[model samples]
Target: MRTVEEHQAVVTGLLAPLPVEDVPLAAAAGRVVATDLPALVSLPGFANSAMDGYAARHAEVGTASEAAPVRLPVGADIPAGRTDVPPLLPGTVHRIMTGAPLPEGADVVVPVERTDGATDVVTITGAPDVGTHLRHAGEDIRAGDLALPAGTALGAAQLGLAAAVGYASVPVRRRPRVLVLSTGSELVEPGRPLQPGQIYESNSVLLAAAVADAGGDARTLHFVPDDVDQFLTTVRAELAGADLLVTSGGVSAGAYEVVKDAFRGLGTVEFAKVAMQPGGPQGAGTVDGVPVVTLPGNPVSSFVSFEVFVRPALRRALGHTSPDRLRTTARLTTALRSPAGRRQFLRGRFDGEVVTQVGGPGSHLVAHLARANCLVVVPEDVTELPAGAEVVVVLIEGALQ
Candidate 1:
């Protein structure tokens, strides 16, 4: 049997990063930048007023005070967005609004609070330092400077930065297209009447949603029966557009294992049992040059396997800098026992420092898996652990209500 890390390495080695493409800024969120984006124009492209004030020569108001006020005639009203206004005349103050372009030859700005409210003649009672209340050109970012570096995942702030730098579209890594399939003759679609021995098909929906949550484009084909020829035909038909394929079921050592039988001697495909509970039977390979990953049939097992393997591969293909789930340590709220050889990933709820098991370690307990916000990990050799024992926890859900 392969160790968990060995299987993980094998899964990751099956595919390379997807190609990059240029996409509109509207669709760039969650996509990683392909190259460094430089600023096309400086922020605050021109010098402007930082406040509503009077533009004047600093030397004229140097000695102005409340006891001895200096009165000057307002030459012009400089409102925002007015570009035809002339430069400030010496010894005269201009009434300037916030964000208005600073008039040339103006050495200082005196706020309205320090002047009497007059349109024609204003009484200046205070003096300000030179260049006060002025926003200089390129104060936020300079033109031709690096606005966003390569590998940056465009979030709200990153998108805003790109827009500020005048980017309508950005070069980014393409989102991976994943084909998710669930195979079994005993599976029926949900909401339909099931026969005596059939159950509802759910792994496709579960795995597809998981792929989308990891920022990949996912499409699920209808469930295939336990026929190797039909499964291979369907796979080949859909393999043209998919970067990776994920199949659930038909991998265990059963007589009707269509997935195992179809690719048994492909030379590129390998099926093995990993040293992990709930998801021991795993498969990885390439079919017709497209990466294929086969997961176990149980709902919980498929979900856990996706979290352990497929999610990382999709994230890496999307160029994520940190591809693994957030991990931390939490104390066990109760004593628990695990098997001797397989590393256990028990569904759990972590309340900051203490983690409580949600259900028994059964691979088919989908309801328990739904209620879990974390996976409490126990090493292979640990058969039993007492209450309050610290265990490594992978935070599956960041915020749990």
Candidate 2:
């Protein structure tokens, strides 16, 4: 039997960083930046107004107040996006709107609310200090400055920043393509009425979603029959275009274990029992030069195996700086037991300070897994823990109930 860390290393070592490609900013969201992106233009580009007001020299409008109002002629109206802004005259103000470029020789802005709201000649009721309501060029970021560093995950704000820095497309690592297959002759598709001893297939759906959530492009080939020759043929046909092959079921020491039987003949994939609960039966290797990771058939086992092994590997392949889930410690709300010499990952709901077990340590508890936000990790040497014992927890994003 292999330790969890040993198996994880074997699985993770199979994949390398994917090749980089340039994708449009619209399609770059959730992708990792391949290289440092520098700003093409300074943020703001030029001096502009931060508010709708009259732009003038502070010396002219500094003393204007409601008690002693000052009257000035408005030279030109400047709205946002007006490129050819006229200069402010010696004794005149420009009616500038928010985000409009500041006219040459203008140093201050008197808000429209503090003015008489006139076009030709406006009465100023208050005076703002020099540089008020002005956005200087390069205030946010200077031209040629680093806008986003390598390995940065692109999100809405990151994409917006890239666009603001004049990047229509960004270099990012290509998403790994995973071909998912679930085997078993007794499995039937959902929405189809089940005959005796036949169950609806769910591992393909579960594994495919998990692959996508880990930044991989997943394609599921559902319900391959339990014949070793047929399974091998089916997998080989679709193996050409996939970076990885992820399959669930038929790997255990059972009579009808087609995946184990077929892959053992190839002499590439290695099947082993990982020293971990819910997902002890694990296998990792390659099939015809493509990486393969075989997970157990149980719903929770498949999910946990993907989380513990495949998710991090897929993210690392996609160029993510942090490939693993967020881990922290929380006190257990109740006592828990684990089999000695086997690491246990129990589904739990963590409320920042404390974690409560969602259900018993059963691999088939899919509903319990659905209600869990974290995995309460019990080490291989640990047999039991008292209530209030601090335990390690791995937070699964979007898994909260």
Candidate 3:
């Protein structure tokens, strides 16, 4: 039996970044960059006004104050969008609107609150430091600078940053295609009639959503019956265009183990009764030249294994630079024990300072997963842990709600 770290290493080692594609900037959120995005042009493309005010030379308004103001003839009325205006002449002020391009030879800007409102003759009553209330050219971003690093997962801020640097489209990674299969004869799809010995085939839906959440293009195939040749036929046909294949329920030890039976001759399925509870029955290897992984049937077991193994792999394959789950140590609020030979993962709610179990440790407790934010990691070779002992936990979710 492999240790938790051993299996985790196996999973992480199989991940590599996917290929890149040029996509529009509007649709680049949550996508990864396959190439460096360098700034082509400067932000604030040209010198512009930061406020709705008069653009003037500070020397023209020498000692301009409320008691004795300096008045100059308005040379040019520059609104926000006008680009054909001439430069501000000496001894004159330009009535510049917010975001208006700064006229040449303008060294200062005075807001309307400090000046009398007039389109022809502008009176300045306040004193401002030179170069104040003005946005210089390339002040925010410069040309030929590193806009974003490679392998960056582009978010709203990143897309906006790239757009600010004049990028209409970005080079991003394409989302990986996935086929999620749920195999079981005792399963039925949701919103359908369930006869005796049948439950909703939710694993496929759950895993498919999880795959999409991890940045993959996933399609679910549920309720594949426990038939060998028929299942093999489906696997052969449906595995097209998928970067990775995932299946549930047929990998575990049982009489109707379709995945375990069907993939015996085609590929190497090294079964591992891992040194971990709930998700112990795990298998991973190539299936006819493609990487396929099998997770246990139970919802909690499958979800836990996905967090512990598959999600990181998919994130990596989708171009996540650092694809590992965050782990932290916290004081336990409840006493718990684990089997001597298998590491146990307990669902729990974790504050930054402490962790408390959501419910008792059980492989089938699906409800506890809703209220928990992380899994309290209990390793093998330990039987009991008293309350208040510090234990390591994998942060499945952050900032518990």
The number of the candidate with the highest lDDT is 2
Per candidate, the number of residue pairs that clash is 0, 0, 0
Candidate 1 residues 93-210, lDDT tens each? 9999999989998878899999996899999999788889999999999999999988788999999999988999999888889999998888899999988999999999989989
TM-score of each: 0.88, 0.96, 0.92
Give all candidates' CA lDDT scores: 0.90, 0.94, 0.83
Q: Model 3's lDDT to the true fold?
A: 0.83
**Tens-digit lDDT track for model 3 on 240-306?**
7777788887777778799888987675766777788879988887776667888898888888888
Q: CA shift at 345, candidate 3, in angstroms?
A: 2.5
Candidate 1 Cα outliers beyond 4 Å, as residue runs:
52-72, 105-133, 397-400
Q: Which ten residues in a row have the lowest lDDT in candidate 3?
A: 8-17
* Residue lDDT tens for model 2, 114-164: 998999999999988888899999999999999999989999999999999
* Residue pair clashes in candidate 3: none
